[model samples]
Target: MLAATKRVAFGAAVMALAVGLAGCSGSGGSEADEGGTKGAPGAKKAPGPENAVRLIGDGSTAFTGAQPNITPPQRLKPGEKPPQFVVFSWDGAGEDSQKLFSHFRQVAKKYDAKMTYFLSAVYLLPEEKARLYDPPKHDIGTSDIGFGDTQGIKDTLRELRAAWHEGSEIGTHFNGHFCGKEGGVGTWSVEEWKSEINQAKSFVENWKTNADLPDEAPLPFDYAKEVVGGRTPCLEGQKNMMAAARTMGFRYDSSGIGNQIWPKKTDGLWDLPLQLVPVPGREFETLSMDYNFMYNQSGTTSGDPDEHEYWGNQMRDGLLQAFDRAYEGNRAPLIIGNHFESWNGGTYMRAVEDTIKTVCVQRDVQCVTFRQLADWLDAQDPATLEKLRGLKVGEAPRAGWPAFTATDTAPADRTEKH
Candidate 1:
């Protein structure tokens, strides 16, 4: 475990800036094998009676039916053990020169896994129209990470359309990558946060006009209804963000830090936070993220060439350890965050890919998006969830899975809507 002092210091440093599957096998079967009634990514239609697709503002997005490729969650039967859940989310997700956004979409398909992509609003807004963004405390056209180029915006739109069809959740990362105390998200009020959130949706809901790509196909889902939650930039302003979000119908927020334990609702939103995992051979732990690994390993994005491999392996091992603790012990969901960056020779990216390949194929594991996890959480009985939350990090029920979750009350007729 990380000492309190070091954890605070390290978290602050990492947050000061740093903007950025499975089916084939296993005892429980891959997510693809679990429920893949929908056709391939681009072929599946949204679920609806008429299955009509009405275009929203400027035809940037459409009111497609329910998202495809996602299976509605079921309540755990009496004395049943929970399946291990792992969420691999990307921050500032956009397809740029690196092509990582599209690359990972293919990777998820191959592994039979699904993920969450926290799309930064600026990614869909072309650089030429940067002035369109009205960040809370920053000047007009001011963005710490800047806006994407024309082609980058188009490529990102294509990926967003396909990713949703493939069952991945598209959450917001808000607009502008502001951090620290001065004019950062932390200082923004709830109203300001609401404004930021609205703008984020606006950029996506009207990307066709904003980016001048009238010929591009409309995004498959409505941004207003599709986006159920998000992580604040640098994980700041979550308190205010959640306050603003809940009233706007958000179901969860992933902008806090926690240990390996089942989540609980806070302020009416499921608080799915990044966890503190071991840093390989080190005594202290760091947040389960790529930038923290880079910060602790070399304190620079361009670290020693020889140490890149070691650093990558260290991060991979640390995440695996975190997964193992929850998979084999408490059955808590593992929340991991990353940026679409190639810092440290793209070592962290490689590490993430390796981790996905390793864990997504394991028996009884489900690599799903935050929204999916929230749906599962919602299906559980409140008392059952309270009991599950009683277990400490990495501490399994001494009575065993069946005996521990055993309930005498009649089960609730709960059903999840993907």
Candidate 2:
């Protein structure tokens, strides 16, 4: 699925509005987190009791106790500044000939960062077993992104396990990659979404059986509990998807578009959507995703070879521009999305890696996964968050961080309107 050509087109107007986990300590997820105020630093996992690895159904996943390396989120002190959170996420995550999934994992570790990998379950279901997926509106075994081969499944499984052990999040990109009005996810009923969600989880929970890898070690985390959120295919079907996701205990949803502002709960889940960032030299902004940038710059995956370098730098600089606005202004979390494909001669991958290296190392900046961001949000005072939300995108408080959040007001829960 990583190598498939994505033909979905996102317009700038729609693009501007879209919205779009622990591993154990020292499991070699990343370098030890350096202690910084409000920054989630890398830490060692407390040793689990003997025989803590209890395998789940078909031995595809296991219960491994609390995820390691995650620092318990603490409420912000009266005058504390919020950390500048930068989330790097991937959709339909898998490993193929390009090996982007594994490659990015190493990049995150080297930069002291953790990311969210939204796995498309079809990647684990071999082509011969494709019929196992009953997509909402498509024929059985149909997937626009295609299915995995035996070796692809094994390689993807290796990355998933290591990523979890290293403290990154593993979310669901659902199954079949269906979109559009004809039986696409946009038309799915809440129950149908539920079915798709269940099927996605089932594939992960039973890959050992589906892929005939019976001897493989179970995934280190219980996916049912671990997968708390995801970005939908093509960023479609969010309204009903959130409805279904909330009922399923999802803590967040990233299927919408927004400015670089603080997030709030919508429909009982954190509405953490992808954001609009400048396109560097362009007059207008676009969603902070590689595909959207590619859509606007070259309009196709294979654009002019000469322009590849320029296109990549534009994305990297765009992300940095967004990061700077947040880091120096309202301190809103900068949410970014990407895929494992080497779109535009792997320029997007390079852009992502460069952005990570540049921003994640900054003091008081936490380059973390969505799960960690949600945890931090949950830890903050509602009144403080309300005040933070009042500050518009790229707007900082006049009196500064200390006086701005000095006192908590008793405001009702601020739920976002979709």
Candidate 3:
């Protein structure tokens, strides 16, 4: 393990802030942060219906921590700021025939960017990166089915289901790879959406339900978790899709990147928005403005030294850009996007490796996963989440000292929070 960097004072700060949080809302309790500090946990009210998700700082503040394990240097330093630490993530976390995942993992390992790759069609897809880690940072995944060929999508899902026993999670990647700008992410027919989810779950979890294996070898991922923690084909930000996801038993979706807060069209599922990943965007000039991007080492790449050269370099720079923005704007996390297939091309892998090296050495940033972020939010005071739900600079009275822990009754409500 890379030498653990000295911890930050966020814990102490959190405690102090919790007091005020408790003031405005009735949320209080203990907190556990390794060698940090311990406070109180909120009282467990009746588990509200899915739509009644009432928790402070829920989903507002998060850390997307993950990177492929095979890439080169990507270490994070203490007190490192975003651009680097403000990590985002990609679903379909797996090693393809081109060794894309292995390459990206190297980037993750170096930067300490704890990424969570959503596993899906990576099952029998192809092992471009030979002799890879059995479970490639397999956290949760989307696009379980729909491999385009439609040929063995079913068989492939079966093998993946076996891995699911260990730690691979499944989510929706789209009804049938129906991606692109105009794709009907939130506007898909109800039955079509239902079929997409139902099929993926059924095929992906075949071993779980019909397994005759001994109980000792538990599954790798959680099938019962509704693993719907992903986005659709296109980056079409829509409320209808959210509402549909909720109705379909999904708790979260990584579809919305730019937009913050639970959209009004929520179907009760959590929106984990996909910010920007490392893959190249539009063209050369479109590089710098590449705030939110996706990466895959399997596509066409530019060797342009500045912004176009190796996508890896561009991503490193992008990380810096995101950090500056978050620090300047107080944004807690930065979500990047990518695809398993994207990392398959020629130069793409090299770019991924280089980018990984850049992220590993950065400081102050804590790479986290979607689930971890949600958990982090779940642990925070409800009021804080509300205040941050739709973070806007002009929205006077930003988060400050004396972190409020109590949401049910907080002082901020009277003064500025509300």
**lDDT per residue, candidate 1, 107-141, as tens digits?**
88989889999988887877778899888878998
Task: For candidate 2, write residues 1-418 as lDDT tens digits.
Answer: 2334334533312433222100000001222222222324675544445326688887898987667667777889987888899999988888877778888899988888989999988888888898998888778878877777778787788888888767889998987776666776778988889999999999999898898999877788888999999988777788999999898879999988788888999978999988889887768888888877887777777889999999999999999999988888889999998887677798988999999999999999998899999999998888788888887777777666776777753233222321
Q: Candidate 3: lDDT of 313? A: 54
Q: Point to the candidate with the largest TM-score.
A: 2
Q: Which stretches of candidate 2 lie over 4 Å from their true place?
A: 1-51, 408-418
Please report how far candidate 3 places residue 147 from its true position, in Å: 4.0
Cα lDDT tens digits for candidate 3, 128-203: 2112212112212322131221222222333233322222233544323333223323345555555555554553
- Which is the better candidate, 1 or 3, if ranked by TM-score? 1
Deviation in Å, model 2, residue 29 alpha carbon: 9.9
- Which pairs clash inside model 1? 21-111, 21-112, 21-113, 22-111, 22-112
- Return the TM-score for each candidate structure: 0.87, 0.88, 0.53
Candidates ranked by TM-score, best first?
A: 2, 1, 3
Off by over 4 Å in 1: 1-50, 408-418
Report each candidate's C-alpha RMSD, comma-separated, in the order given. Answer: 8.7, 7.2, 16.6
